[model samples]
Target: MTRCDWAENADEVMTHYHDYEWGVPTKDERETFELMTLEMMQAGLSWQTILNKRQNFKAAFADFKVDQVALFDDADVDRLMHDAGIIRNRLKIKDTVYNAQQLVKWHAAGKTMNAYLWAFVDGRPVVNRYQTASEVPAQTALSQQVSKALKKAGFKFMGPTIVQSWLEALGILDDHLAKCTVNHLGKK
Candidate 1:
C-alpha cells in the first residue's frame, strides 16, 4: 500500500508510527500528555530520534502520567539530565514537569487537556488534502491561536510551529497526503 512519503522506505520505527499512530484521533489522557511531551522534546531535533527513544522517555517520565511527572523535583531533573537514553536537555526536562503541573492545575479547575484541545476544532478533526510535503505548512493561524493559548495557560516550549506539528500528530489536524493509503486513519 502507498503510505505517506514520510514513512515510505523509512525505518521500521517511523514506518510503524506512521502506519499505526500518525493522524489517528485519540482521547486517552496519558497518550495525549505523552505526545505533547514528545512534541516538546522534538524541538530542534529529528522525529526519528524521538521515535527511537520513545520507550526511554516513557520510562523516564513515569509513562507520561501527568500527576506523576508533576511531582518530579530537582532530583528527577538531575537524573533525566544524566540519562543517555533520552534527550538530556535540562530546560525541556524542567518544562515537561512544569507543563504537567499546569495540566494538573487545569484538571483541578475541571478542564482536561483533551477537552481544551479538541474544543479548538469543535470536536472534530480538520482533514487536509495536501498532495506533497511542500504543500504542508510549518504553522497555521489556528496553530498560532493554540500556541498563544497554551503559553497563556503556562505551558512552556510549545510555540506555533511545534503546536502545529503536535496538532497534526494528534490527528486534530489531519495532514495526510492525498494518495496516502492511510490518509483517513481509524485505529489502524
Candidate 2:
C-alpha cells in the first residue's frame, strides 16, 4: 500500500515529508526545534515554501539549536531578512527567536519541549485511521487547546492549523493513510 494520504494536492515536498519523516517518532531536541520553527514560519503559507527553504533556514538559524537561536539579536534578524532562503517575515523571524527562548525556559522548568509536546500523547503516538486526505482536518479541538496553552506560555506564532501539523510531524499524532504500512510507525 502507498504510504500516504492527501488533503489536496500531493505536492512533491509534502509527499517526501510524509514518506520520510511524518509520523516518525523523533526524540532529538534539534529536530523538534526545527519542526516547530518551520511550523510557525508556515503560518499563512504553504508547507512547500518552508520545505524548499529548509536548508536556508537551517543555515540562517544556526541549525535550529535552541540555545543558539535564543541568542539572536536585531542584527541576526536583519541578516535573515535579506537572506532569500527564508520567509523573511519580521514577526515570524522574531517569533522563532522568541520561541527558542521559551523552549529553553520550558526545559529549565523541568520539561524539555520534547517531553512537554510528546506528553500530550503520553509519550506514545496517537494512532489515527485516516484513509484519505479529505478526512484530514486542518485543525482539531486538541490543537486548539494546545495552541491556547502554548500561547499562554509566552510562545509565539503557533495556531491551531500549525499546531496540528506540528503534532503530526512530532509523531504526537499519526496521520498516515489507512492503507499505509508506515501508519503504525512500525509498532506491531
Candidate 3:
C-alpha cells in the first residue's frame, strides 16, 4: 500500500488520480488531449489546483473534444475567462483553443495525438527507478525534443517542462519512486 509520498496527504480526488490514472499509459486521443491541456493549464500553478477544476475544464472545453474546441472563437475565450470554476488565465484559455486546433489538424492528417506522442518513446513507456521524488527531473532531453516538435506542429503552451509533466501524466515517462507500490506497475 505504499504510495508516492506526494500523494500521501492529498485529498480523495488526488489520491485516486495518483493511484489509478497517473503514470498509466493511455492511447485514447481525447484523454491524451485533455491531459495535455491540463498540463499547459498547470504552468506556474499546482497540479492540485488543476485536478480540483478538472470537471470545470472538461465542461468549458467540450470534454476536450479536439474538433469542438478547435472551433472555439473569441466568444469562447471570453466565456472561459469569466468562468469562476476553472483557472481564469487568459493566455492558458486561448492556448487551449490553439492547441485543440493543432490537434484537429493532426487528426485530419491521419495522425492522432496518441500516436504522435507515443511514437517518441517508440510506443513504450520509459520507466524510471527513483528512490525519492527529488530524484525525478523536472525536464529531460526527450521532453525537449517533443516540445520542439510540438511547437513546430503549431501547438501552444508546450514548453519542455510542461511537456515533461504531460509525458509523465500520460505514462510515457514513468517516474514513480522505487518504494511506491505503483512503481512496479509501470513495467511490462
Output the TM-score of candidate 1. 0.97
Order candidates by TM-score, high to low.
1, 3, 2
Residues 1-188 of candidate 3 have per-residue lDDT tens digits of 88888898889999889988889898888899999989998999899999999999999999998899999999999989999999899999999898888778778889898888899989999999799989899999999999999898888889999999999999999888888876436432
Model 3 global lDDT (CA atoms, 0 to 1)? 0.89
Best by lDDT: 1
Candidate 2, residue 97: CA error in Å? Answer: 0.3
Q: What digit string (tens of lDDT, one per residue) describes model 1 on residues 92-148?
A: 999999999999998899989889899999999999989998999999999999999
Scored against the true structure, residue 11 in model 1 reaches a CA lDDT of: 92
The worst-scoring run of ten residues by lDDT in candidate 1 lies at: 179-188
| lDDT of each candidate versus the true structure | 0.92, 0.83, 0.89
Q: So what's the TM-score on candidate 2?
A: 0.90
Which pairs of residues have clashing backbones in candidate 1?
Answer: none
Which ranges in model 1 have alpha carbons more than 4 Å from their true place? Answer: 183-185
For residues 1-188, write the lDDT of model 2, one tens digit per residue: 47664523477777767777888888888999999999888888888888888898999999998999999999999998999878989999999999998888877777787877777777888788887878988898889998998898888888889999999888888877777764435532
**Would you estimate the TM-scores of all the predictions?**
0.97, 0.90, 0.96
